[model samples]
Target: MTLRDEITNCRICAERFAATKTRHQPRPVPWFTPTARVLIAGQAPGLRVHRSGKPFTDASGDRLRDWLGMPPEVFYDLSRVAIVPMAFCFPGYNAQGYDLPPPKVCGQTWHDRVMAELPQVRLRVLVGGAAHRYHLGTKAGVTETVQNWRAYAPDTFVLPHPSWRNTGWLTKNPWFGEEVLPALKARVKEVLND
Candidate 1:
């Protein structure tokens, strides 16, 4: 079986997820192909994506697509883009109803292997702190890391999570829109067209 198959069949997080408020089963939404040139390294699936079995199907996804300057048709095309998260399933909600962080074991078990399958990836868009930590090995906070986007641009772009919760963050970080995004969009277009 392919690496994708192995991940889809994984039940390692079954018991742990059952303990969450959602008490959901493991539904790995591994969306990628070997031919993809752009890798979207996101945090994890949210409840909507978990239910739909598609990555980036929520409001956050809409924001992400806008960030990329991509439409759904282009964003969802497996031949050109690979959507690999730090975790594959929704980690569920905490006591306060905020999303729980992705289970670390998911990355430990599958990330390297999944990356190996996508050898053609020319651009990596790391969304959120978890993805930034995993892909860029940075100890910096999201704001700092994203502020230094030029350090990794044209190849990788580290972004804060595009969730509605970060609306305040977006307002505070106007440079993200005025500076990083134009360069990012150009890079994304260049890479995808290449």
Candidate 2:
């Protein structure tokens, strides 16, 4: 069976998820194809995404798409864009109702394999601290990592999470919008249109 199918049928986190406040089942949302040119490596799915079974189906997605200057048609096109999160399943909420970090086993089991399948990817967009940490192997906090976006630019763009929870962060770091995003949007357009 294909890797996608394997991931779709995965139950590796069933018992672990069954113990969360949500007590939800593992619903892996694997969205990618070999021909994809852009890769969006994000944190785990939010509850809305868990329910939709589609990556970035919430307000965060809307913000991310705007950041990329991409319309939904292009952003959702399997042939051009791949949305792969650190964990395919929602890890469920904590007692405070915040999303738990994605289970590491999911990445440990499938990340390399998924990347191997996408040999054509030319642009990678790392969203949030989890993706930044895993993909860049950086110990810096999200703000610093994103501030140094130039080090990985033209091919990769490290970004803060687009969740509304970070609105204050965005206000504090206006340069991210004025500097990083314009360049990122241009690069995204160039890469996807190439």
- Single out the weakest 10-residue window by summed lDDT for candidate 2: 92-101
Cα deviation in Å at residue 48, candidate 1? 0.3
lDDT of 1 by residue, 10-75 (tens): 999999999999999999999999999999999989999999999999999999999999999999
List pairs with backbone clashes in candidate 2: none
The superposed Cα distance between candidate 1 and the true structure at residue 192, in angstroms, equals 1.1
Per-model TM-score on C-alpha atoms: 0.98, 0.99
lDDT of 2 by residue, 1-194 (tens): 99999999999999999999999999999999999999999999989899998889999999999999999999999999999999999999888988899999999999999999999999999999999998999999999999999999989999999999999999999999999999999999899887
Q: Residue 68's C-alpha lDDT in candidate 1?
A: 93
lDDT for model 2, please.
0.95
- Alpha-carbon shift of residue 122 in model 1 (angstroms): 0.6
lDDT of 2 at 78: 92
